[model samples]
Target: MNYTLHQLQIFLKITQLKSITKASEELHLTQPAVSIQLKKFQDQFPIPLTEVTGRKLYITDFGKEIAKAAERIINEVYAINYKTMAFQGEITGLLKIAVVSTGKYVMPYFLAEFMKRNEGVELAMEVTNKARVVRSLELNEVDFALVSVLPKKLKINTVPLMPNSLFLVGSEKLEFAKNATRKKIFENLPLIYREQGSATRNAMERFITKNKLSIRKKIELMSNEAVKQAVVSGLGFSIMPLIGIKNELKNEDLHITPIKGLPIHTTWNLVWLKSKKLSPAAAAYLEFVKTNKKDLITKSFDWVKHYDKERMLVKK
Candidate 1:
């Protein structure tokens, strides 16, 4: 069929979202514009690629197969562009990483300089929970994953980047008596938590179990931002990563309520599956991180240590 790459792209986006209107929004095209392109793409095939029954749109089995081919063609086109840029001695290609939700805050700072130095490169990152990040590694879907911990079942290589520390945080509106105990914080406020399979949630669970701490009530949210917002609104307290709440803590929207065994520390690591071969862009990024991470951390991450020191002054 004589079809343009843009048609394949629109079809693929429609298949993924299962809604033409949503695809149009994602592609930054008007609904009518997307509809015209989709209709033009479908005209080339005798059999229907997509079918609509009432309100829902469905891609046929034939459409699913075509979507796979479209992805391969898109990758090939990208590879050609990257190869041409490399001939001119530039590090080029898409560097895709799947990061745990809280890692979104940490990875961007590391990426900013690398991206600036290599103008030919492009970035794609999926910020999700730990389980999805690990699944992406298993599928070889991404070049790297940023996590504070990796599952023992996965054989992977790791590059330790910086410390990831979690603290028990509450809304600044929380008030305590002059001699209030740490246990009182738990008693006074409901606990907000990230959903299951989140590394933060797992760590919080371990701490609670070991200390035999009783949570009076809890609210489960799916993301770090959600939990933080809940805590900021005085709905509850949560065990949140220090990196993700620096600004909130500074603005006095949240407070690191000093819990006895808190500020659990782990090293944030960049990991990739051992069996997956690295692309040139991925390899270049690996080298850059290895060479510059120490200096980068010192320059940009001094706030973490400074915050820790200041937190110590919040007594029992």
Candidate 2:
């Protein structure tokens, strides 16, 4: 029973991404190529490594044990490579990361600064939904993730990056006043919503349920951008994170109204699996984020203010 390092890497990536297509894209291989590698690895083990449940890929119990061993092997390999490179005085490697879609706007700025300081390092970033980001972190597919919602049962460390504000927004054509009271707003419009498993969707549901608001006739969309577009087309109103609607608010394409006594705050976090080993590059990047996160938070809030003067208006 023999398996190649490449096969292990592919299996690890598949487990991390939970999709052959995504793992292939990250590895720069075709789907067939990735499937072939994974098959070869599974053949080396007596037990099945993974199974497909509905549309999701799940690792078997035995596969989880194998993945643990594979992590140990890979960590040793990385340590050896890191020491060799250190001996040669070169600090270079790929830092693979996954970020939730809302983080897309702000993380790039911070990453650009980090790259400038560390010219030898390269980054491979995937902008994905919150569910995918959690799956990736749980499987050790990515070095780290930038997200707003943390999973409940995962033993992971999270560095608070910034505080996010969620708002209820509607199309300009909806005939709803921009300053309408929360009660009036709810009574007057149908809700537009993000699909199940979205952080925004979860937050919206909790808020609405807590306030005893009826959400029976809502149009659900899969992405924040899609939800925003639906609102622009007058499909319905939605609760969205401020990051997603900054440009629309700036251009007056969307109107926002606050819900009095609504709790809509969430903290963006830099998260990684608690027991996973970090490469030197990943560690350095984390340290960089920790040191400059205050500046990053302030800059993010600057955009928040530019889009919604009400945030500042209320502060006064």
Candidate 3:
């Protein structure tokens, strides 16, 4: 039985996401279309490739083996294409990257520069939550992933790209805006926090535990934008990436509360699996980031300079 590469790619996505609808969304195919292709591909094999229990999908043991083979086939095909392009002295191919949601703010700036330099390159970027981004990395689905916090569970190589400091921000109208201590802020204010699985949330939790701060009243939101809006409307304070609040700070829509021992400094990293072989484009990008990370970070996040000035004043 012959299976097209496209079908294999679709099946790979399905296995990774464990849902037809999610795979279809990622592939930009209708669910029925994806299901039909998946069914046709499964028909080629006598044993079932996947099984569904209740609402969740599970890949059978045979499916796991097929998935591994599919990955090898995909990677080798890409490697050969890259070799051919290199032989022709061409700097052109697909550059797929997955970035944590907060990274979306700065990554496009660098991608724009990269694209400008390599006009023949095709770029695909997925802006997803950290959990999905990590899952994508685990599945070797992207050349690189941008994250603020490194996943301790994954054996990967990482390059520090820039600083990703977290700041406590709230509506400017709040009485405790200027000089609230960590305990004071946590004990009195209603804090708005990102959903449980977000990298931002994880960082915030670690900082809270380290500082022994307890949030008394809190509102949980799923997205950074939601948390920011909630804070703007005086719903609560939020710990947000400094990169994400440049506009709000400039417009005075929000104010950074200089709580003592605050503004947790973290670094954004470009990460990839240590064992996977890199494509030419990915290798070039890794080299480019290595050589130009400092300048790129400054260029993408120049507003941080102003924040630094504010932090200095807050200290005084």
Candidate 4:
């Protein structure tokens, strides 16, 4: 049976999202358009590829196997395209990375110049919580991972890239704006948190346990943006990476709450497992960062250094 590559792409997306509506949104296609194509693709097969049970769609075991083959075919096609570009004397390949959610703010700046310089290279960055980012790196699913908090029990090499600082932040209009003690601030504001397995959440937990302070855990959000929105809405305060809340801080939507021990400092690092071999694009980026990290920081991350002055409020 002959099926178009477009159908295979749509089917793979369906396997990932598990809902036609969701897959359609991801593919930027209308729901009816996806449904019609899915039905056509199913007609070419004898057995059912997907089944709707209890009102939720589930891919059959056979469908999962087919999707795997589909993925390989799609990747092969991409390789052929890249190979043609390489034959033309251009640097071309996938440069895949997995980064923790807070890293979104810093990774883009680091990549901008590299991407500009190597216009033929393709970039795929997966932004997720720390656990998944580490898992992707551990499983060799990506060429590199960006992290502020290093993982334990993982043998890896890292190149330090940029400064990452976390501070207790609240709405600018937070009550008792000035002269509040550390414990008193905790008493006043319930702390919003990133969900479990998040680097920021882990940092917050370590701080609480180390200080032996009773923090009211107001709510848990899955992303940095969500936590920021909660804080800006006066729902609660959160410890956030300064890189992410820069705009909010500038707009007077949020402020750093200078506590006794805060503005937790960590450097962002590009990490890769020692055993994994790097592709051309990956190696290029690694070399680019190593050679130009200082210049990159000066150009794209000058504002990050301004937060060092905030460090004086808490001391080293």
Candidate 5:
């Protein structure tokens, strides 16, 4: 029933970093001290808070739930502190964010701008896969997530950031023959693909199935960068977000070809749980996305132009 603030802080840090040594370093405590506090807290509760996998520490499910509660409690305490500081005309706090991998390419620009305007706020950001990003948001493990796909079952609020188009691309040397038809292209080349459960992979699979096309060979990869590398090496072709491959495309390391009824388009969404309370910093970020997303997309990406052209042609 009774716990020290240090205990809760340590739990939250350990859960965030998933390492005792890292949590200890952040908290200015020794590793043993961090472990002792966690142990004391766990002894009081019915379930263990953390488990060790090899040399790495993992917060257990129960520990994660407890850590979520601790985060909310800490945030509320900080809010009170912020109000006290605000009375003296000061705003200061840490903002934690988890973003899916592709968002890393763009969100940092917006975040840098936000940080410049709000000098008192500190940011902690983690770039993770879409599934982990969504799970972290669902569990209140992160303040918000910049993600590409929104889970249908979660009660969450979403602000649309930009539309992302998936492109079928390959090295210039391996480009589809100029006269090759869509069916011929699919039948002729091996396909480099992101692993299952990836948003890109899901979109690509849906398009392939809908069109009833069987790729010549499928090579599964783990990262967008890896897929690009594979395509650049002429290992195979891949479907990837246009934003992810802009530099390569520009450098002529990769070339894109249009498939009949291709280029699956989806939106990048900023998500937060409906029931979750946002801190001042988090609220500012949400507002920033709402007001500046259009300009952000327009200035940073050319995919929007491609999509607009395609849509206009479809309308015609």
Candidate 6:
């Protein structure tokens, strides 16, 4: 089939997002424009590539093969462009990343710094739970994924980026804040939990189970921001990543409830499928991350310390 690389790009995006509307938005093309290209691409093949059942889109087996091929072609094109740019002593290409929801606190700063250094690089990011991020990596929809918990089901390459410290957080006004060390305090306190399937939730659950902490009442929220807001309103105590709640604690909007066996420690990891070929941009990101990990973690810790000091001074 005679098809342009642009058509393959659109088709791959449609498969990744599973929606023409979302692909259009991501590609900065109108819905009709995306639809026209998709139709043209589909017409070249004898059998239909995709089928829509209700609002859900399903790629046929042939379509899946095409998408896999398209991804390889697209990455190879990027690799070629990267090699050409390297000859001129420049780094330029697209960098796609998928980050777990809790990574929102850290990934943006990293991206901002990396982008500043490599002005020619374009970025696309998706922030979701571990499940979706793992799926994206498996499908080659993202070049890398940032997460605290590695996917056990996949054979992936992992680089440890930093420590993810989780603590029990609550509004300072809560009675439990003053006596969080007491098991009864935890036994009596209502708990807010991250949604099921979340890495944060999984980690917290494992810790709680290991410590045998009894959560009297529990409610689940989907995002870290949501959980923080809920805790800020004194809805209940929740285990939160220290990075995510740094701002709230600094502003005195939240308090760390120092229960025993506190600060569940997990490693923040950069993961990708071992089988996927790394394009230049992706390889650069990996190297940048490897070389700069200490600085990134140090900067984050420094900020946390500054915030803690300021908050303590205010408390006095």
Name the lDDT value of residue 183 in candidate 3. Answer: 82
Q: Candidate 3 — which residues are off by over 4 angstroms?
A: 1-88, 177-181, 309-316
lDDT of 1 by residue, 183-273 (tens): 7767666889899999999999998888777778989999999999988998888899999988997898998777688789988999999
Off by over 4 Å in 6: 1-89, 177-181, 304-316
Report how far off residue 108 is in candidate 6 (Å): 1.9
Question: How well is each residue in 35-131 modelled by candidate 2, as lDDT tens digits?
Answer: 9999989988789999998988999999988888888899788767766767778666779899987788767867888888765676889987889
lDDT of 2: 0.81
Off by over 4 Å in 1: 1-3, 30-32, 39-49, 61-69, 119-124, 135-141, 153-155, 172-178, 273-276, 298-302, 311-315
Candidate 6 lDDT tens digits, 199-258:
989988898788776778989998989988999998888888988987788788987765
- The root-mean-square deviation over C-alpha atoms between each candidate and the true structure, in angstroms, is 3.1, 7.7, 6.5, 3.5, 7.5, 6.3
Best by lDDT: 1
| Per-residue lDDT over 1-316 for candidate 5, one digit per residue giving the tens place of the 0 to 100 score | 8998778998899899998889899889999999899888888898888888888787789988999999999988877887776676654677788887777776786677777776667799988777878788888987888877788879998887777778778886676567777677778899887776677788888888887886888889888888889999998888888878777876889876766666777887778899989987788777877788777766777555764365322100
**Deviation from truth (RMSD, Å), model 3:** 6.5
Full-model lDDT for every candidate: 0.89, 0.81, 0.85, 0.87, 0.79, 0.84
Candidates 4 and 5, the one with greater lDDT: 4
Looking at model 1, residue 227 earns an lDDT score of 91
After superposition of all CA atoms, the RMSD between model 2 and the true structure is 7.7
Better of 1 and 3 by lDDT: 1
Clashes of 3: 0
Clashing pairs in 6: none
Per-prediction TM-score, please?
0.83, 0.68, 0.70, 0.81, 0.70, 0.69
Quote the positional error of residue 195 for candidate 2 in Å: 1.3
TM-score of 1: 0.83
Q: By TM-score, who's the top model here?
A: 1
Q: Candidate 1, clashing residue pairs?
A: none
